[model samples]
Target: MQAPINIALVGNPNSGKSSLFNALTGLNQKVSNFPGVTVDKKTGIAHISPSLKANVIDLPGTYSLYPKSADEYVTYEVLINPANADKPDIILIIADASNLKRNLLFCSQIIDLKVPVIIALTMMDLARKKGVEIDLAGLERELGVPVVAINPRRNKGMAELKKNIELVVKEKHAPARDFIDSNVLAPDAIREIKTYFPSRSDYAALHVAVNSEELPFLNDGQKQGIKQALQEHHFNKTKVQAEEIMQRYARIKHIMKASVVETDPLQKQLRSEKIDDLLLHRFWGYAILLVVMFLLFQSIFWLASYPMDWIEGGFGALSGWLSQVLPDNKISDLFINGIIAGLGGIAVFVPQIMILFGLITVLEDTGYMSRISFLTDRLMRQVGLNGKSVMPLISGVACAVPAIMATRTIENRKERLITIMVTPLMSCSARLPIYTVMIALVIPDNRVLGILSLQGLVMMGLYLLGFFMAIFIAAIMKMLVKMKEKSYFIMELPVYRAPRWKNVGTTMVEKAKIFITDAGKVIMVISVILWFLASYGPSSKMDPVHEKYEKLIVEHPDQSEELNKAFQSEKLANSYAGILGHAIEPAIRPLGFDWKIGIALITSFAAREVFVGTMATLYSVGETPEDNDATLRQKMSAATWPDGRPVYDLATGLSLMLFYAFAMQCMSTLAIVKRETKSWKLPAVQFVYMTALAYICSFIAYILFK
Candidate 1:
């Protein structure tokens, strides 16, 4: 047995590093956090040969050795600390061939770390589209390292890339050329640094001298020594860094001139720029974005309805058939009402989740997602959020845990905190079922202006409502939270390209699978616990109902079925779940929620999606066998108060929808918020504020409409 070689895939942001990683690793990848850090670290296995396998770690995107954010610092940390677990034996730097100059800066910095290096040149097709050409051999000669042109998205030049990796790892081929004369740059500091860390390369020693205070690997005495050395040499950190960059660029300029032929990629606003001209126009871009938002919410219903119906019908039939065949006992009841109902609740929404993720993925693949940030920069600033916050907030429409995690890219502490606090206010996919069911029950299915769906219009309105609420809250936070640090938005807009269908399909399937499996596990457990609570109570307390039902069954033998259903309903109302729901009933009564809704609300803190499962199980357990075939929507619709007024009329439905929209119902999101902010205070404040808002809004809606 042989240990796989450790290979680090490093590159600047938007340099196609992800494309290369996907090509190399395929589906054999895992995501975990770094030790003692919450930032995500992705690692995968890449087979290079019969005997050679590589554990390729996709390092964080960084432009230079000087890190600015937590993500970039992770990259720099791993590169400098040899003892780190993700330390690489070989480094493959993916560079955008079309934007070689900017990409080369990072490459030059990495090469000086004295590791075996290979340049995986991507975007060659884009380069050629702009009438540019690259001399691969000439580049290899100029850089003193292997340079392989690869189109990872198309799997082009992968074989050569693998060959280069094997060659570099086997030969330990360090770069033979140095772009900067380090001795000339800082002779005294370099000499002093190497004396303390004798094994460090000249460039590595120079870095230690420059960043000793910031580097975790350096000991206090070594840091003090480096500081002393710097002071004795009269070294200026900024001045030295500037000179180093200038010298490296001077060398890079010559290399690029010799080996690369440039054409004016912006000569006539290529197709991508042309599209951006309209999509990024000061006036039309905003309008187009709003239209896109409207269509996305509408399609979540229109496209997902077919599959949702099929899944619901299939599950309902299965539940009914199982009830018919299996004897009606506690075990059977638990299986049908608890596990099956819970899983089915989540499964029914799988289509909607798929559609939502697919749409988001499409926008990302088309490069329009970045344009959204560009368009929203000024608007976001007015609300005290960075433009980068817009992506996470919009992505919140899919989920908040990831969106909260996405706040890591916001370098400004105050802005990042504000984003994490307000992101959950944006309606997520978990809220879809609530919104969809409520809208169908309340909002009409008729068309407006003959081209728009009235029900869908409501759905879009809910999403917009959340977004506007986020901005409004952000504005308030902007006024409240004091900040000393400045924030800026720097993004590289990827050129437009046709969506890679294979990758898109893979993402959709993978995301959908994750959603169903993850939610299914949590929901099933919660449903089972809920079922037990709803099915059984203190025998002392429930004995009377049982005796009453027994008497009714004997007294009216011809009506045994109706009596039995009544008995079960009475038993549930006396059960533990019922008692708990009743305890909170008064608090929610003004907002139009009954005891059953209270139970759902309490159980849903584990996850917002659990509300569906809770409702399904609660209502299913209370239903007569004759109505077993009815869908959840049908059952909910047929529900009524004791006075015969419908329980789920327009007012109650809209109130519930608005409650879920604004509530901080997901525990996962809260935990992530706590982790990102590193304080329980923020999550506490967030939960309190959101819950209060949801209640107030729901109360207002119920008052106005009822």
Candidate 2:
């Protein structure tokens, strides 16, 4: 048996490193958290040969070894610490072919670490299309490393790449160059800094001593040594280091010019910029974005309605059939009302969620999202956020849980916190069901402009309302929280390309599976518990009424069996759940919610989509003799309060929509926030603040409408 070799994949941002990893590993990968950190640790196994396999790790993308934030710290720590279980046997450095100068800086730093390194020239297809030509053998000789030009997207040159990895792993090949000492500072100063921080990687430590403003969690001796080094160098350390980076680039450019060729400059077009001019223009860009967003929301509601209705009706019929087939028993009731109804409720929205995420994935993959971020940067900065927040904010429309998690990429603490805080305000897919049901109930479905539905227009208004509120809240928080560090945004705008359907399909399937499986368990349990609560009553007080109703139904010679049974069930629910609903009626009356809506609200706290399921179960319990739409809707529409007032008027439906829009009704989101922030305090604060806001907003809306 051959021993497995360890390969580390390292690269700059947007260098196609991840795409290569996905290609090499191809479903053999697993994403796990690092031992003590929340940062994702992605690992996979690749078969190098029949007798040999290799372990591959995809390190986080960073420009340099010097770390500024937690995510970058993971890259630095993993490379520097050999004792880490997954330490690399060989480093595969991926460099963007189009930006060789910037990419080579990281390559130079990696080679200096004395690790066996291989350079994978990514984006070679783009480079070729741009009329850039390279003498691969001569370039390898100049860099003193084996280099392979790979177009990972096209699956070109992968066979050669894998063969090279095997040769290096089996010790059939040797590195083209050995480590050379290149001290960026005076020798004595470097020694002193090293003495104080013995375990720190030398090059990274030197970079930090020169560039970082303040080093947190450093000892007094280390700090003093760094300060002394800076003073003795008699130069601004950062400026000197920047000059060194520039010098390295100059050397790389000289080498490339000797060994590379440009066949035609015209072929190297600025297509990305041309597209951005229109897609991200100051005026047209934002207008296009708004129009696209409006269309997305409209499609989500309109396209999903047919499927959603089918799911609802099918589940209702299935439950009715099960109730009729099974013997009248508690177990049958649990299966029919608890498990089936609960699971169906959550599953009904899967189509809408999938469609929304699929569209987002397409937008992101095409590199259009970055342009939006670039265009929105100035506005976001004014609100104390970097343009990077734009992605999370937009993604919040699919779900806030992942959007909040995505904030981990933002380096600024204040900006990231504000992004996390305001993300939930963007209407997520979970809120869509509540919004759709309520809007359908209250808003007319007339068309405007001969194309747009009035319902769609209102939905668009609510989404925009959420977005503007996010900006306003972020601006206010910017004033409230102060930090001295000046921050700027820099991002890669990859050339536009058609979406990869394979990648999009994989992402959509994975995300949908996670949502259904993870949230499904909780929904099922809550449904069963709620079913029992609404079905069974206080035995001592309700048993007599139930028995009397049962006896009265038996004695009715003219009544059909189904009608009698429905009457008995309705009487039983009224005995317990109904009483509870009335108990809370006065408290909710000001918000225009009656007992049934209050019951749905209470049940939906576990998950927002439970509103539909709760209604199904409640109505199922109160089934009538005819059991037709006219009967059910009429009963629901005419449901009366103790004072004989109707339950679901336009004002009440509007209030419900507003309430769901603002409420922190998702347990999963709260859990994820706690996990991401690593504290109960943030999630707790969010729950309290959002719930209070929901109450106040709903209350005001209801009052004004009344």
Candidate 3:
């Protein structure tokens, strides 16, 4: 069997690169991290011919060879660093046909790297609609590479693309000549560098001279040698880069004139532009955005309620059945009270998670997500960030680990840091379970004006609160973190298209699966551990309760059921977990969190959603067999302190939700922050400040609501 051909799919942002990868690989893909970095690396297997398969790597989208952010650096490393393990055997550059001139500059640079290249021109339909025409044969002849027009979304041109891939591999097709002579920019430096790296082309060696310090693959000796050579030849790096870009554009202009034609250079606005006029209007845009957000939060509750009820009921029945059938042994208790209860807690939220991810996917597919950035740019600038930070902050609502990684697109260091520090304040999907459970507990389900759900309005308010607080924190950080580099926001708004229902469905399923597999594992393990702690204690403490309960049951045989309930409560208060929870109770008492809630707060640091599972487990451990039919929410609602005050009252629920919104609870997020900033200092400071903020906010919320 032949080893798979390594093919890297390179393209600019919004150039249909992701669509092409999905089309080619279908379900044969998996996402992992790039080697030694937190950036996502997507790779998959695509069959080019019956006898051959290609390992397709979807590298991060980048504009040019010059790298600024971490994401661009990953792409630059894979393409330019020969020692990179994932280096491609062939480069398939996906270029947007409608924006050919700008895309061509990147294409030309890749061509000069001497890799076998094939140009996949996407958005040709859009190009044609915009009065642009391209002669494919002429383009192929001019660029000295195979150029194939493809529409990956509709599966058009897949056969031709596959055929071209096969042919390119067979012939080892590379560009016939340099796109712009690199040696002309720095003749002496290029010549000297090539002698040291004889196998490299002049263009590749020139890059080494220019970016030696940034390139990770280069050894210290090579870097020093390259610097010495550049100095000896008096090679001006910035000037050479400028000259290279200018020269490439000069040639690209000639190519465009020869092979491409625009029917009207100044055509009327596109349909997208016409729509943007109304949708992007200053007054209407924000109103529309608010309405959109309101509907999104409302839908999460309204749509998922049926399935959530069904799931909750199913778990309740299952727990009841297990308690009755299982032999009342320790193992049975573990299954019923520990694993099953924990699984039930997290599993019930799957419907809501799917709804949230699915809606986010729709916004992205329709390109309205970019409009959001544009709409919020002014507000973002006021917070020391630009529109670039909005996407990451918005993404934080789904998950913070990837959201923090998305901050790589922000080039300004101080702005990026501020974005990272504040992003966790956004209530993420993990917190969705917390918010949903809490709101349903304390907030009324009644509709205001007989039309809008009060619960939904409160949900929206919580989300908005997080957003506003993020900006407020960003503003403060702006005043604190000192940096002089000017920040600017530049982005291209993609044309709106109908949401790809298939992609949206796929994302919904994938996110749900991730929630189950990744978070479920943690919840189940913690649930079992907590059950053990809550069920047993030091024999010295436990034996007294057992003796007291047994003696009382014998004395009052007629009221034995009531006595048993009292005994169960006494046992729980004396259990190992109870002692642990008690130790932290004083610190949290002002925030309305009892010892049980303290245990959850401590355990949920692993992940925010674990708070639900921890409560389920703790409550299950204390419940009598008759209470097994009750849901977790029911169990929590009935819970009370020794003084008889309900534990999950309005004040407690609100305080708990506030704490989660502000606190840095997820260890994974902290780890990613450390990796991204490449230091422990930032993450430590972030954890401290966020925790402090959470404590303060939670204390205030408890006081006001209590």
Candidate 4:
């Protein structure tokens, strides 16, 4: 059996750290939560050689060893704690070749641990294209570590990287570097502390004496001992730590100057910067962003309709067949109405979700997302949020679960909290079905300026409404939650490169799979429950009516078969489900909702998309038509209230759409929030507030229109 060598991959954000991990591990990676924290832990297995298999751990991205947030703390803890199961036998410090100075800050800290460290110089191609020539041999000599250039996206230099890893493991070569020493304690105290510091520990005990306050798990005694040592040594730990970081950058710069060559001065001036000059311009940048968002909304609405129709049609056919084959019983009705209807509801929106995520992934892979952050920074600061909040806010449009998780990168406690609080307000793709159906029913299908559709304009308005609300809510929270830390925005903007299709596809597939599996189970269960409720009724009341209708059909032998079928439909619906619908009819009457619509709304609490599925099931249960459209749309159009008013009029549909837009209808989202916030209070508050707001908005819309 081969012994597994543990290798740690570390890098700055956007240094292709994730891409490199994906390339190394491929399908071998597993994503988990870092123990007791929401931060993601990614681990995988990579074969360095035929004889050498490695367990690779990809640490959270950090600029330096000095930690700021919980996510950043994970990076520091893993590096500092040798007892961690995932601790690396060899550390591969990855650096972007183009931004060597900034990337090397963390690299130098890793090297100081005296670990068997190697430099994986990523993005070397991008650096060379801009007239920058890195002398690999000279860089290796200066850093006293083997350096291998790799383009993880293209699988370039991977062979050389693997060869170096094999050699390092065989030779057990450790990089030599200057380590920090804090002589703050008395000689006797220093000797006592040294006993606890093992040779295998990466950093010296003195380094801990200086940096321990910045760590996450230090107790009172450990903190006091470190403080006393610093006091005795007459050292200001904060200043010393800052100096160490700055010195490392300076050293990296000096080494780069000696080992690297610049070829084309103008090559650095890429189209991205030129585009950013206008796109990130304080004035036009925001305007352009808004216009781009408008286009995205329009695209989503127009592109998703065909696939949605197909999904609706497919499920309608399945349910129709199931209703015919299953014995006329509650279980049959539950399968047709509940499970099929509910799953169909969410499945219909998959296309829209995929398209939206595809666009987002493209923007991120091509490095445009960083520019979005840069453009929004000043404006975001005014709202008491950091620019990093913009990414989460944008992601919220797809779903708030990932959006909330994405806030780990923001660093500021108050800002991250504010971001999470306001994120769900952004119109997620789950709400798209509701919006699209309503908008199509209410808004005119005319074209404005011979380009923009009127329906598209209304959709754009809803998206803008959500965005502005998030900003306003965040600003209000900023004033309410007072904190001492000054908000700062510092980010690395990667050079523009062609979007990597492989990366984008992988991300889209992974996200889609998670969304389907996570939410699918809940929706299916709710659908079945709803089906049962809607199918069965009080047998004493329903059986007599059902028997009478069957007797009438048998007596009217000359009557058309279609007429008998319609009579049977009326009698069956009048059963338990119909009576239940009538029972709740009074409550929803004010909102222009019939008992059937009420059932749909109640079922949709499992997920917003279930509304359509519920409607489809309810409509299909009544009678089968020639085709889905003729059956669904026509039946829906002909639906009437008790007073002979239309159930699904333009006004009621629009009101329903607005309701779903603002409602916290997703149980999965709430569960995720509970996990991420580590408290039921936050999600509880969110659910109550959003649900109340949605109810009020929907009620007003319905009343005013009626």
Best-fitting candidate, scored by TM-score: 3
Candidate 4, residues 1-706, lDDT tens digits: the string is 3799999899898888888898889889998888888788889999888898999899988888777777788887887776677778899888989877777777877877777998999987778767789899998888888999998888988899999999998899787555333232234444544554443432445456556676555667767776676576566556766666666667877887899888876666766678778877888987887887787778877787788788867876776676666787656655655666667766877877777787788878877778888888887999899788999988888888778888988877888888888889999877777777667666778899998888888888888788887788788888988886777788878777788887778777876786678666666665565555555567787677768767876888777476555654665467555666777878777777778877777777777767766676676556533332333454677777656887788779767777777788888789888887789998998889888877788899888876
What tens digits encode model 3's per-residue C-alpha lDDT throughout 1-706?
5779999999999999999999999999999999888889999999998988999999999889888888899999898878789989999999999999999999999999999999999999889888999999999999999999999999999999999988888888678888888878888888888766553578888888888888888878878888888889998888999999999999999999999999978855799999999889999999999999999999999999999999999999999998998898889988999999999998999999999999999999999999999999999998899999999999999999999999988999999999999999899999999999999899989999998999999999999999999999999999999997898888999988999999999999999999999999999999999999999999999999999989988998999989989888889889999999999999999999999999999999998999999999988988898889899989888888888999889999999989988999999999999998999999999999999999999999999999
The residue-by-residue lDDT of candidate 2 on 1-706, one tens digit each, is 5888888999998999888998888889999877776677899998877887888899889998667666677777667655567778888999998777688888888876666789999887778777888888988988887899997777887999988887787674435453334464445555656665553345545655654345444657667767877678664666656666776777778877887788985664567767777997779998998888788778877787788777767765676667667787778767766677666667777777777778788887888877778888998999999898988898888788768877878888889888988888888877876776677667888889989888888888888878887898789889887775677788988888888888888887886787687667666766676677777777776677667667876787677566565555566456567777778989887899877777888877777877866765565555542342222233456565557776666778778888888888888788978887888998898889888878888899888876
RMSD versus native structure for model 3: 1.3
Worst 10 residues of 2 by lDDT: 625-634
Model 2 TM-score on a 0 to 1 scale = 0.89
For model 2, name the residue pairs that clash. Answer: none
Where does candidate 4 stray beyond 4 Å?
Answer: 177-192, 196-204, 211-235, 263-268, 315-343, 547-587, 624-635
Positional deviation of residue 641's Cα in model 3 after best superposition, in angstroms: 2.9
RMSD of each: 1.6, 3.7, 1.3, 3.3
Clash count, predicted structure 3: 0
Candidate 1 TM-score versus the reference:
0.97
Model 3 lDDT vs. the true structure?
Answer: 0.92
Listed per model in order, the count of residue pairs whose N, CA or C atoms clash below 3 Å is 0, 0, 0, 5
Model 1 RMSD in Å is 1.6
TM-score of every candidate? 0.97, 0.89, 0.98, 0.90
Tens digits of per-residue lDDT, candidate 1, 1-706, equal 3689899999988889998999999999999988867788999999998879999999989888888888887898888887788889998999998888889999999888888999999999888877778999998898889999999888899999998887887787789877677778888888888877764368877777777898877788888888888899998989989999999899999988999886664544568878988999989999999999889978988898899999999989988988898897889888888888887888898888888888888889888899999999998999899799998898899899888888888899999999999999999988988887788787888989998999888999999999999999999999999997788899999998788888788888988888778877788888999999998898987999999989888989999988987787788889999889889999999999889999999988988888899999998888766666678888889888778899899999989999999999999999998888888999999999999999999999999999
Clash pairs, candidate 1, are: none
